[model samples]
Each structure stands twice: as C-alpha cells, then as structure tokens.
Target: MGDLERELRDLSTWLETPEPPDVRAQVRERLHRPARRWRPLAAAALAAVLVAVLPPTRAAVADVVSGLLRFAGVSIAVSPEQTTPSGVASPLPGQRVAGLDEAQRAVRFPIRLPAKLGPPERVLVADPDPTGACRVATLLYDGGALRVDAFDGRLNLSFHKEVIPPGAEWVEVNGDFAVWVDGPHVLSYVDRAGTVHKESARLAASTLIWQDADVSYRLEGARTQAEAIEIARSLR
Candidate 1:
C-alpha cells in the first residue's frame, strides 16, 4: 500500500479508539469544558493536513494545546522545526546562558525556584526577543530546565508558541491544567513582536508546563513523566 493510504488507515484507527479515562479527566478539568470534545481531534486532523500538504521528507506532527487559560494570549502549539544539515543543534539567536544572579537581573519578573529542585545550576536569559515584551528566562537543573516567560506590555497580544512534536497529555497540577508532552521534540514559538523562533529540535526529554499569574512556566528535559510532575508540584 502507498504511504498515504497507510497513514489514513492509522488515523482512522486512532479516531475510533477512545482517549484514556485519566487523560479525559485531565482535559475536562484543565480546559474547564470551555473546549468541545472535538478540539483535540481537530488538532490531530490539522497535523494530518500539514503532513499531507508538506513534502514527504518534511512530514511531522504537532499538537495544538489550548483551552480555558490562554496564558495571557499566548497560543501554545507543540510542533517541530527544520534542523541543520550537519545535525548540529545551535543555540537560539539572541539567547545567552548565564549565571543565576546574572539572569535574575535581565528579566522584569522575579525568577521562581522549585522547593524540591532548589536553585538551578545554569540560567538562560533572552532579551530583545522577537516579542519585545519582557525578557524570557530559563533555569536549568541537572535533570531538566524550567522556563519562565512573561509579558509586561499591553495585555491580549496574541502570539504563537510551539513546544516538542505534539504528543501532549493534559494533567491537573495544583488544581490547574498542565500539559506533559511525551518524548523529545523541537519546541518553537512566536515572540510578542510577531517573530517565529525555532528552539533546539534535538531535545531528548519530556516537558511539563503550567501557568502562574501572568507568567507561563515550562519545565523541560525531565527524565521521566513522574519526575516531571513531582518537580512541577514543588513550584512555589
């Protein structure tokens, strides 16, 4: 059979199967029922559409993660990006990796550290991002990296954000909807300034993210799903 036919058959099979009970609960709880049951399915279809449109060599999948909380108008999309020909994962342009004290001074919002994780061993700060909002900070622990992104400019500015290659399962964390993307995929997003960014597409870990106030916190590079959730719960 042709590849397209095989893909269609697989999609049909998935559509017929029901989502796991636990995942259903998480989606219902976090999205607050604001989204219909077909939203995720639609997202899956969108990915399929992209696959059909893009070249066969560029075929990839992404998950659209949106619901009750908009994360201050930040649209969360888990998609992949193009990579280098040499297979080298280069640092994002206009990004700097610095010490904790140095990173703290760069961003407008206060950096948060998980009680269980303590201070991060490394800190990455992004200033003058495409968004031109406030600075973005990423705290790197041994097991994973915690990202803190904020917008101090006007509210309701819509921007597209992407993370990992689309297998996100919703889970309740601290009574809030949090997403855990399985496997390592490239994470990309559009900054407030309407610029698209492609982070490293070579990440080899899972990620967990939730919102706190106006800041959207993302924890990446976890060794396991349970470890990621445990660390996320420790955020204060």
Candidate 2:
C-alpha cells in the first residue's frame, strides 16, 4: 500500500465505474428466475442481463455506462500501460477486521465463503451506509493470494468499476454470467453516498465477478479462469 496511502489521503477526486459455461440457454433461464423471487430492482437487473443475453454473448452484452463498458452491474475503463501492479490490494471502504460470525451478522445478505477454498484466513467487513448494514464483506485466504468480496448489488448499480484494458473474458459461475480479468486492474466503486472512490493499490492479478441470489461478488488473485470459476461455483 505504497502510493495508495497518499492517494487515499487526498481523496475527493475520482471517477467511476462475463462469461459462459454451462449451456448458454441455461444462463438465460437462471436469469429469468430471479425476477420472480426478487423485488423490482432484481427485475431490472435481470432485464439488463436478459437483454444482453435477449433474452447473450460477451460482446453482445456490452452496454456503455458513463462512457465506460459495463455488464452484470459492473463498469470498466481501461487502465494505462505506465502503471503496474504493486502486488498489493486496496481494502474495501470502511473495512474493519472481524470474526466470520461478526462479519456475517453485519451484512443484510449472506456472506458466502468458497467451499473450494475452505475457510478463509481472515474476515473483513465494510459498513458504508447509515442503515448499520455491512456494504461489503471480504475473505482473505492463502496469505492474501486469494480474496473474495461479496456485496449487495440489488440496490446499487455500477457498484464495482475497474480500470483495466478490455480483454476481460466471459466465464460461467453456476450458469450465471461472470467476467474474468486476466491481468492487474484498478478497482473503484460508488459508495452509498454516491461519491466516487478509488481502490488505491488495487492491483488485481485476475478476477471473477458474478451475482448470485442478489449478492454480487468479485474473487481476485486466482491464476486461471477455470480455478476462479470452480471456487466461485463452490460458494456456500
């Protein structure tokens, strides 16, 4: 977290902000089911996914949001070549150390842990809103080589945006659309207050993002798409 501290100290000035597997039709069918079980926001999110699909290819799903490419509630803008990964990651906003139980109790939704990776080494929670609910829960594993972050995306659009080149490919996470970033990227998000903030020192090696049961998650530092998806599908 070198320059990251400096950047965070300055703050106040920042901007914003997949895949297949399983049968493609299966993904569409799964997307359809959420609308019935969820409220209107889920419906809107489902509609976005469905339209990208009809009711989908990775390219077909592309929708420009705030002048950046977007999909599955995440936005992307390519990062510059000059900057390189420092092998360190930025913590989520308002993040604090906590036990797993304490972390789960803080969030409205379930904080799923990947069964494939067993228990995480550490649990962190971020409370960014006034409602006393955790906005994000992060699990760190393998000396931080693997990390999973779960956040409520039902009410937030463009919640996680990244600045990395456009080659992120599509993969499958239990029949839902997921995106994988193969290289390091700059991560940012819109807080509950709608202010933009940068995930300083956020140099992701590889990432897999998918939404399940209204929780949107991003798993970082996996070395390959297959491994990322396997861990993601094992979430429980």
Candidate 3:
C-alpha cells in the first residue's frame, strides 16, 4: 500500500488495541469526531475565488524563521569544520582553541551585543587539541519564551513558538545533509565553496545564508522574513 495509507491503517490498528479507560475515551473523542465536508468545499471555493488567499506552506515557514533571527540580530554561516566530522573532546575551563592561527584561534575579546539582545544561555568550548585534526566551538543560547540557539562548528536556532500540525516535522534542504523528527531549530555554517541549500518541511519559517572567504552560514528558524533580514544585517 501507499505509505500514507499504510500509516493510517497502522494507526487504526493501534487505536483498536486495548488502552486505559481515560486514554481510550480521549482517542475516541478525537477519531469519532464528525467530519466537516463543507470545509474542504469552502477551501476549494476560496482558492478559486482568491488566488492569493493561502500563502505557500514552505514560504510561510521560512518567513517565520527569518523574522525571529532578524529580531535577535544574529548572523548565519557555514564553517569548514562542519563538512568534516571532528572527534574533538569537550573543552575544559581556561583552555584555548587548538590549531587555529594565533588571531583566529581566539576571540581575544568578549562579543559585545546591542542592548536589544540577551546573553547566551550556555556556552560550549571544544578541546584545543582533539584526536582528529578538526577543532571548533559550540555556543548555545536560550532566548526566553521558547527560543534555543545551538552554535557549534555550526549554529542552529530552534524555537518551539507555534503548535505544529500532527505528525509534522522539520527538514533542511541543504547544509550537512541531516534530518530529524521533533528536531531542534538549526542554523549551521559550512565551507565557502558548497552550493546554496534550501529546505522545506512543516513549520519551517525561513532559511538565510551569509558567506565570507573562510566560512558560510545558514539560518533556519521560526521568524518572519523581515526579522530574518534584520538578523542577517546585524552580522559584522
């Protein structure tokens, strides 16, 4: 059978299995609800009547992610280290980044932000010397009210800001080639030469890209396009 049909059938069988009384009642209430026929008809009619009535789903998600990033004034990039997996040890206190040039290896100064932004929730430092040749740092921020930032050799921004449709999940079009169900929001950086990537799944918001000679970054979060643009502009 088709995947969707198979999934529905499996779900039906699971629902038929024995369950606690309360759980069973809740399931019944959900499955036995009256079908709304007019709604579909109405949607079709609306589509016919107004060509622009519904925004494209992928565009909608991208817009959301971009907006949030812009609001935070963050930048996206793809680092060279991301393309190759590095088995680096976790950083200990008071250690420097290994292998990088004297200047590139260290931030030298703390990152100063505008008054509008909050400090990161957590910071991860990688061992200066790892078994492999690769070395990088990870920075995490928990922007209050449901925003999370995971910045490693790459940066990922995940915000549980909206209610996703049942069975919905996030997907990326490009960058490191990974996918997950119930995955956190991600903004990643890779080497400069890689092709631009685009991804679309349920509730994606938007994806943004910034490039430089050494690193390139991608932003995937739940914000509007204007917000995403603002964040992109803030990177210096």
| Candidate topping TM-score | 2
lDDT over C-alpha atoms for residue 47 of model 3 = 25
Task: List candidate 1 stretches off by more than 4 Å.
Answer: 1-88, 129-134, 143-166, 199-204
How are the candidates ranked when ordered by lDDT, highest leading?
2, 1, 3
- Which scores better on lDDT, 1 or 2? 2
Alpha carbon lDDT of residue 80, candidate 2? 46
Model 3: CA > 4 A from native: 1-118, 125-136, 143-206
Q: Write the per-residue lDDT of candidate 1 for residues 55-100, one digit (tens) a residue.
A: 2221223333432113333445543552332345555446787787
Q: For model 2, what is the alpha-carbon lDDT of residue 173?
A: 74
Worst 10 residues of 2 by lDDT: 8-17
Give the CA lDDT, 0 to 100, for residue 101 in model 1: 75
The C-alpha TM-scores of every prediction are 0.55, 0.67, 0.27
lDDT of 3 by residue, 100-156 (tens): 243133432223221223434443333233332222332333442222222222222
Clashing pairs in 1: 131-192, 131-193
Supply the TM-score for candidate 3.
0.27
Better of 1 and 3 by lDDT: 1
